[model samples]
Target chain A: MKRTASPSFAIYTPDSSLRQPLRLVGAMFRDLSSGRELAWRLAVRDISAQYRQAALGLLWAFALPVANALIWLFANASGVVLIRDTEMPYPNYVFTGTMLWAIFLEAANAPLQLTTAAKPMLAKINFPREAIIVSGIYQTLFNAAIKVVVLLPALLFLGVQPSGYLFLLPVAVMTLVFAGTAVGLFLTPVGLLYTDIGKTFPLAMQFMMYLTPVVFPIPAQGIAATIFRINPVTPLIQTARAWLTGSLGTDLVAFGLVNLGTVLVLFLMWVIYRAAMPILIEKMSAS
Target chain B: MSDPLIKVENVSKKFCRSLKRSLWYGMQDLGSELLGRRHGDNSQLRTDEFWAVRDVNFELGRGECLGLIGRNGAGKTTLLRMLNGLIKPDTGRIEMRGRVGALIALGAGFNPVLTGRENVYINAAVLGLTKAETGRHFDEIVAFAELEAAIDSPVQTYSSGMTVRLGFAIATTLQPEILILDEVLAVGDANFRHKCYHRINKLMTDAAVILVSHNMDAIAQTASSLALMDGGAMTVFHEPVEGIAAYHDANAQRQATTSDGGTTHQCYAPVVAAEVRILPAEVGYQGQLTVEAEITCDADLPEILISFTATNAYEQAVMCWHSSRHPSPLGLCKGRQLLRFSVAPLLLDNGSYHWNFKITRRGSLEHVVWLTRHGPLVVKSRHRTLGNIPYLPDASQCEHRMLTSP
Candidate 1:
């Protein structure tokens, strides 16, 4: 049989992919495009399977943020802790904060979770590995969409009027996703190799939430305020919350800067992931 | 043959013995990869490291199947993984052209919580088929797997056989240009297995196929050439029969060395010495084939039954004879005894056959002595038949008449 026009072929060698920067990037882009359909299929499969067995179904997506908001509301209302005054009602403030935080957390955890789940497939099949990462992004977007839909209705229920900047809310939420997915993709290689990263990741995210303006307002002139100002998540969360609540307290410049840095880091980590996967798969299969 | 579709050159891979060290080395390799530094001098092994596959080279063109036969841990899987591009070789290069499909693990990406229909789509996607493509083939896959009734049921609810059937159906329907099958046919019932072989034979005509299996029958049926891998090294055989023979010879040698102390069960009535002689070394069809055995018994067993079994090259017992089934049972005294077993018309096809002798107590059926003699008595036939056993009627008794004209 004659060879097909533009027959697909691949060469595997010990030479580092980094040695061929242009080709590596080209292949990455190619795989990214080709992997889109697969990503959608996997995402659909995962989402269907995930909710199929759940008794509460989509409510589970709201469970974490709602529970978080209630705990803080209880703490504030019961005088167990004193929180500073905010421009909006404390309930609105904490609820929006917790919802956006959940989006960020889910985005950050998606890559590792999906990749770890697909380890067996990755070791056996030779399809574009980038599909897993794309699938993770798809799932995160699906989850973030759910939270945003819930947040918009809840904001109106809490007496906050929809503002003209409501369209910008998606942008802010996507920036948060970008930053979170970047961190997650960066940690995925090591996280897959070691349980230490997967174990300590949630704890670190929890601690980071405290440093960010998640539930409580940023403190007034203290070490806590300095940490909040310096934390990259601070601008993302503050911007998202401000846009959601229709407030003019958005940190546009810092958000832009953080997103720019995030794109660069995300791309770099993607390359690292592509380079490290074969080695990781080899080791994983050996064990 | 057309230009080679798969070319592998001096490919080798190393593995670490200790898990901890393996992880550590993995990290180091990742670091080097990230730094854009080529693997420096990986030909030498570090501490606790050994070569899993070493210096293996072969090229395969279209319409050829290479049967890779090896013992466990001989690196057949490692080599296949490299060829499939799941992992990279540490010291060599592999060039694979066309779409390569690997049935390394059936139902590899299957999620048990999902229905069979859902998993089929997901598995097809993972194997590089678009959703539209999968949709087109969905009904055929379901029909082939015979899961039309339970296609909507979760895969976890399906039996292992059902799942494997679904997996095999989806994997084979893609019709890739290069197919790698690793013991995937070693499952399912006899009927399904036959169907799978038929499908594989159809796929082999246009694809460059690499099959890794321990079953000699499978290799003999599918492969045009063979590769014998032992201890990370490979020896290529142009002929499938020669490769099967080498594999059997290697296995026999290994068994012989391992069983140096003998496989005798208890100290009861043991056969001290035995010799088996075939009357005619090369027997033709419908000829008299006789097996005579001279036995030296250490103890008297008055009611022992002796049985002789002839096994073919595929390790299938083709024929057996038992003294207990005869008009009178045979016994062993405390001395040398000669026993002769004969078949007036051997109906076995052309192949090599080995003999197995067993002596058991008549009533209790307790094994008195058991021995396997690898005589490999040759059977030659001018008339070739499709199956193992051929029907050879007496010349005067057999008559044929054509009822219809073509």
Candidate 2:
């Protein structure tokens, strides 16, 4: 009786959907809500399938950040390059930085990764497109959780004291995730269309890491310091590391402003993604 | 009549021939959408662009199955995609009232490393079913797929047919009010196919269905009305018989132009020239028919086998005659050879037909020299028959007897 009384109805037209802003936003929210269960199922499926065959399993998630930390420690110890004195031990500082950066990188890459993996289904099934985005977030959060589990113990073992500020670590880590996801979501439409984006994304992220105080402390006064201060990633990562190490020099104001900006930009990118999906799917299916 | 559940109005979508151009155009279109600008006159095509589905219109009420019959690349899938809301049409509007379920790509998102049990839940979720709903249908889905024993095994271990069966089962379990199917019936074994059709028939009682399939029998059995698509355009036929006829005529015409005179195999003994002639160019039902073929050979051959297949107007092979099965064997020398084949009392119903001839070496099934799609062999009959081959016995062979009532 309910099904007959209120059968779902949908209309698709060539007219610009942006012309109907209210409807567009309404549909977006509706799909996002309806897509949650599907997104969770997909995330579970992907996470299980990903590590099932890999002998390394969850170690693969830890592999990247740990290896990066090891590489930087080796470089710092061998005096291969001059480094600024960190407020915390170099090992602890770089370890926390790389761990946080890995979370950011995973968040940044999740949108495109999940989307590309689901391209076949995207072209064929008429499911809520937002499910892919939500699935990406689920996976990102899952991976971030794993990295945090590894980080907390490793940080304490490395002589860093957990402080009262530790309660804010999740907020800081989420802000970084939000910022990274915003950038990734913004690029998803074009990235889906072109191979060049996927190919060059890693190199671009690596270059950005050097500017974000991931491998080295921010230069006291120089062109590098100017760049680091100007980089939006700086405050987010620095605050997350400070929260973990109980440091007093956290830029809370800049971090909050960056978080606010990330929210606005993420929403804007989501709208763009929603609008561009049909065209992208058509192009993808056609080719 | 019930209110129409699906209505499509003058929908058209353009695609670029070159991938580069298509991506570039996609970027431009995305920019316009982002800027809130109207998609600049969709009627006009840019360079390297052409309309994939042009000006298609249709409406389907509940309980109606609209069969889409067309050659490959005839925009049937494109139109279906638009109706499924997977992609937007560049030019018109599509209104779908009620939940839309698509079997366009069964098992589309199946992860091979996951077990069939897991994949079913994922697939059902993708079709818009909740986890609890999938759980409720889990046993039925597995039973329908006949994979109860292997359902726990990883999908990678299952055969392709098993996977398809699982996909079909999960997709159909949703029972949405609008179903979009694209060539899904072409898979699975005959028994499973029968089950799929039976399920679809049940689903059709309360749903609007759009089925795109090349299988004519399936179309005729399922569709209430048929839409024949050609060159991105459509002609609707309320009568399935007329639509199938038009489809066959179109097929015959296209085959005539593009036969390529059969693909000539460059074997050691190649057929240089070949000609086939019927004893009587015009054949009548239940008449003795004789066929003669002259094949010129380039080299001497020890033993050759010739086979003849006669296909009716619907492209269904009605009769087959092979030479190797006969008592005598024929050989070819380094010259033109005349091969004669005769059939007595042809039982084919009145219709136009084509003959396909194949010449192969003895002991080998591969065609050494093949001449295909040779004729419009017209057969006429005094009394009309119902099916392809009429059961007409010769008068001398027929006997009538009167029995006492018991």
Candidate lDDT scores, in order, read 0.84, 0.84
TM-score of each: 0.86, 0.94
- C-alpha RMSD in Å of predicted model 1 compared with the true structure: 5.1
Q: Which stretches of candidate 2 lie over 4 Å from their true place?
A: A1-7, B40-42, B252-268, B328-331, B362-365, B387-389, B392-406
DockQ of each: 0.44, 0.59
lDDT tens per residue, model 2, B163-203: 99999888888777888877766459998889988887776
Name the 10 consecutive residues with the lowest summed lDDT in model 2 chain A.
A1-10
Error of 1 at B229 (Å): 0.8
Native-to-model Cα distance after best TM-score fit, residue B298 in candidate 1, in Å: 20
Residue B75 error, candidate 1, Å: 0.8
The C-alpha RMSD of each candidate to the native structure, in angstroms, is 5.1, 3.5
Prediction 1 global C-alpha lDDT: 0.84
Residue B265 alpha-carbon offset, candidate 1, angstroms: 4.3
